[model samples]
Target: MSAESLERRTRNYLNNNVPQIQDHGGHFEVEDVDEETGEVTVAIGGACSGCGIAPMTMNAIKHRLPDEVSDISKVTVRQANGPRAAVMPNKTDEMEAMEEYQDYNPPF
Candidate 1:
């Protein structure tokens, strides 16, 4: 349940799952896991940067991450490069934005 252990397991899982992605010129990098909130932050780069299916890929990754690592409750995928800046917003800031948006919007 430690952050280090979760990180190692996540990296191993990514290595196993992402070779084909890398072969396609896409890459996934495990950035950090917050033990306090059980959120895993990942960066997707290379061909995945501007991929049309990036949202689907992100959802797939989000669903898979927690299943693979019991300590993780959620996964956040960040585009390392796209229309957005190379440096992504902090996970906390992203979470806050999502929360604020959700407060004013109804669930689909």
Candidate 2:
């Protein structure tokens, strides 16, 4: 029930749950965990962050996170401006980069 363990387990859980959440364009990153109660705080990112279905996305993550990680007693999704802001897209770096690359049109 430590911060490090909480962080690790949260990331692991997210990794496994990614495929399921992907349909909704849901994604998350483990920011930090509470050392005392092992509360895992996640940052909801990607298209799920800023979508009409974001509320559903939040619920899905809330339900799945705890069941996926045993030590996690509480899960907090950080919504900064456009993060978990209920109307913001905060995709992971790789995902965003790939998307950018995909959309890129080279000037030949």
Clashes within 3 Å, all models in order: 0, 5
**Candidate that would win on lDDT:** 1
Candidate 2 to truth, TM: 0.60
Candidate 1 C-alpha lDDT tens digits along 3-108: 8888888888877775655776888888888888888899888776655555556666777878877778888887786564334333433543575534432111
Which residue runs does candidate 1 get wrong by more than 4 Å?
Answer: 82-108
Q: What is residue 84's positional error in candidate 1, in angstroms?
A: 11
Count of clashes in candidate 1: 0
Candidate 2: where are CA atoms >4 Å away? 20-26, 80-108
